[model samples]
Target: MAKSKVEYVCTECGDVSPKWAGQCAACKGWN
Candidate 1:
């Protein structure tokens, strides 16, 4: 069997990551 993964990104910043964050480390947003 195979597994699927989800991706999360900050709308304020163009940080495409696998986890969700409160603030974008690059742009620093409260998203």
Candidate 2:
């Protein structure tokens, strides 16, 4: 089987984060 990569993205600003958080760093939107 192939390994899948996981990514954390912000819905409001489309910013990609290294880890998951309650709020987005780029736009300060809730994740």
Candidate number with greatest lDDT: 2
lDDT of 2 by residue, 1-31 (tens): 9977778999999999878998999999998
Specify the poorest-scoring 10-residue window by lDDT in model 2. 2-11
Query: TM-scores of all models?
Result: 0.58, 0.70
For model 2, the stretches where C-alpha displacement exceeds 4 angstroms are 1-5
User: Which candidate tops TM-score?
Assistant: 2
Candidate 1 per-residue lDDT, tens place, 1-31, comes to 7788887788886788788877777888878
Clashes of each: 0, 0
